[model samples]
Target: MPDPGSPLARLGVSIQHLLPQRALTALAHRISTARAGWIRRPLIAGFRRLYEVDLDEAVVPASGFDSFDSFFTRALKPDARPPASVGTGLLCPCDGTLSQAGPIFEEPSGGRIVQAKGRDYSLAELLADEKAAEAFTGGRFATVYLAPYDYHRVHVPCDATLRTEIRVPGRLFSVSDATSRHIDRLFARNERMVALFDTAHGPMAVVMVAAMLVAGIETVWDAGLRLRPGRDVARIDFDPTVRLSAGAELGRFHWGSTVIVVTGRDAPDWVDGLVPGRRMRLGEALTGPRAPGRAEN
Candidate 1:
């Protein structure tokens, strides 16, 4: 929970219930995508200073960026985040603080993932696809939260072929831990892009959840997601040839957001020592083989 004494906490409450989220997000998109020097340069510099972003790890220096969007989704140096030695079942998808991680629980309607202490949201609501949600029943889920200072690009956690991408449009709410405790079904209520992948272990789903002031979400294949209020969920099927190796670039958020990774029932168990609030780097080990005598899902 956020300190009630903090101004940001109060602002979050106001924005969640009172602000026109879509309009604000669209305005942010325009400003972030602008290439004009006067508009973009200062914003980039200001953000860098405010967040204390480390430019040394970036592929290009901050001065070389033409737009705030480019800097926000900048690539890292080749050696900056090399994948952990092979044979680890999964890898961390992005640099962020681990919000929560554990096994999914089955329910009468579907499986449920923890959103925060004492709060859980249904898998069907989170994915917006009932049949697709079933694949993750009794599986494992990890939610990582990216702050403004973290790298916003998300990568593939393991070798997998892209199967489907589902775009679900909803409110652009703040996903900070403070808000998560106060807002019910926060992730399910936000506009998100769900990408399903088929791996040697089984199926995996990477859900990129959008938050307040987040301009857009993009994939290596699709330019950007189209999110409009009142629009029905949109899903795209990928070609079987579309494949990505572990640690390869998968997608990115135009601004900081959250990534929730869910694996199928047959997926490997999470490595020991995982705890909420642990900071993670891209390409680090996330899972290992199941333990002996473990009950099957």
Candidate 2:
């Protein structure tokens, strides 16, 4: 017979996990395509106020937005951030609440991600690549969650050349703390766009995770890919020759979601202080060894 403690805990987690995904998905679709000027205006107003969105920074202020999708994925002023120097160790790629940021650690391969206090999920599932997973073994990781009021575009952390891109499609679940703590393998299960960029810091990967109502995630290189909420996984690869500058706009989320940066074991040791729940911004240095040979600058 199953242990009583195990069943009870699993039940709580399961129910807690499923509720947010359903409610948020419904909410996402309704708001994203909402056409009623009156209804949509109030909804957008509420989210803007709730998330404390900075209208001054938006390229198209909230009043100019036509739909919730536009409002959610609003662009920022070109001068909002200064250009990043390639010599700096690394720069943050987005403006969001640092939901969780730290090193990826587990005793064995295919180990779990530290979702919260007692939770962990698989590396293989997160990257959706067995060989690619090994590159990040013992490396660092940072997960940033974008709220409705945040800047939606993502930038490059360092000077890197595109190697490949894999679109691992899956369910679009809400990625709130309530969901993160309860959902098993939440990141892996969610539809995500993975871009593999090879850099001097080592092979770095930026995973643009999709959440409920986040209509889709598009990159500057491949702007045509569109995704609808569903259980599916797709993979796309690119030639290894395409290189981009540090802090270059790499991708954008149709609506708010999460962005994760994964670095391999070879990354600099100075990246020791980044922890979960910390805040970050684009073009700010994160970490890199000072040595010229090991540096990407």
Candidate 3:
């Protein structure tokens, strides 16, 4: 595990978060504008070099990209990653480096879940809904961090029909590992979009966490998201009739950020040896099969 309190950790935290709050917010506003494409090119090139991104599998060749965010969230070839076989296990919903995975340690008061080493954020704060928080008490969670070069589009972890989608507005903090380690309540503090699904494994929450420099969060189901901006908390409730299958495109992060997937307590454990800092592709079985006769919720 990364020592979030070590001197090195402290240095990283400082470096990742050197920007002023207002400056970062201005950067986000700029990135969201059409004029930002000028800087996006060189920025994309620099990031590709810095991260040593593999372009071979990208859907649109990297050469085809006109901006950094465009390249960052580039699509993958259809066959580059195949979804896990049906009934296998939880799938990876996006292409990013695995940051951490484990059970959410519930707090004694307020039903908060510790997001990082020293930060405790409530499920209600994370989801912005009392009933939504009720669905995943003591459940499993996986945090995936998208570096500047990872694929930005998000897919489904399992065959889930979307039950409801909520947009919980909050401060936009940097979600990089450095920021996660330094900023208290990083994930919970960020502007986030939560998609709740009813899967075989019970209720699943796919949270697209926004960070500093993130232009916005967009969904395959809605285009109106592009028009909203500001710090107020927002929520969108859907009728029960909407459904989304696993491996389906849930949405895309305008720029890279962290994705947190939470499952009910009955959800099975992760496949052996899948740990932090690992690379995972979509459609791969993340967890092992359930014990016999335990059905997916």
Candidate 4:
């Protein structure tokens, strides 16, 4: 658990509540989308420097990205990552720090999810749909925190068909560790996009949650998704045709955000050694290979 009385933690939470979050996000959106080299180049360079971004892993444009968004969401080299073989159950969807990972408790009201060591929140509240929340009772979940320097794109962890898309609008508080500890139901209260899918293991949810300065969220299906703030929950059902293979791109966040993956009962065990604070890479096997001796014996 984070230090409850940490002065630094309280400062961040206090600032978020006082700031004009929407207006600031709007301003950030303008700067991120600016195509002019004069506007984008300096921002990209400073960000890369500040984040110690490993440009060697990213495919930089010969000249430069027309906008910081392009650079932030730049594609990797074709051979950047190896394909995720079927043997390794689920693949990680993005590159970031593993904030939390484990089983979802079958609580009386929908279910319960862990936010921190001494913190847990309602699964139903996070999903914004009680029915949808029921499907994940007694399940597995992993929350990845994408840093500003990490790759912005998200990917499928397993073969699955999109079933529904939920747009939930709420506060834009920082998804940082400090805020996650201080903000009550941090995720359940954030503006987010919940993508439900029917995977081989069972029902799955990939929640793309927004945070401070996060301009927009985009899925491969809706590349032009212009996410807007709203009061009501909006859900859209998809046809059966929206299927994607393991490791396929799902979507991306404009700057950076968090992704919470949840699976129904009987979800495969995540690869061992996955503890909070560990850095996870996209396409890495979330499920580990069995021991050769055990398999043979």
Best by lDDT: 1
lDDT per residue for candidate 3 within 165-246, as digits (tens), equals: 7777777677766667678777887788888888777888998988777777888888635523356666656765467776
In the predicted model 1, the residue pairs found to clash are none
Model 4 lDDT per residue over 1-297, tens place: 446459967976888899999899999999999988898889888987898877776787535678988889898886787766747379899999999988887766658888986788898999888898988877889999998989999999998999998889998998988888888889999999999999888899999999879998888887666565467888889864599988899998988989999988867777666789999989887876545454310
Quote each prediction's TM-score.
0.92, 0.82, 0.83, 0.92
Question: After best superposition, candidate 2 residue 214: deviation in angstroms?
Answer: 2.1
Error of 4 at 136 (Å): 1.2
Task: Give the whole-model CA lDDT for all candidates, comma-separated.
Answer: 0.87, 0.75, 0.74, 0.85
Q: Write the per-residue lDDT of candidate 1 for residues 109-178, one digit (tens) a residue.
A: 6899998888999988998899989988779999999998899999999999999989898888888888
Write the residue-wise lDDT of candidate 2 on 116-161 in tens digits.
6677777778878878887787787778888766788999988899
Higher-TM-score candidate of 3 and 4: 4
Estimate the TM-score for candidate 2.
0.82
Worst 10 residues of 3 by lDDT: 223-232
Error of 3 at 115 (Å): 2.8
Q: Which stretches of candidate 4 lie over 4 Å from their true place?
A: 1-5, 84-88, 289-297
- Tell me which of candidates 1 and 3 scores higher on lDDT: 1
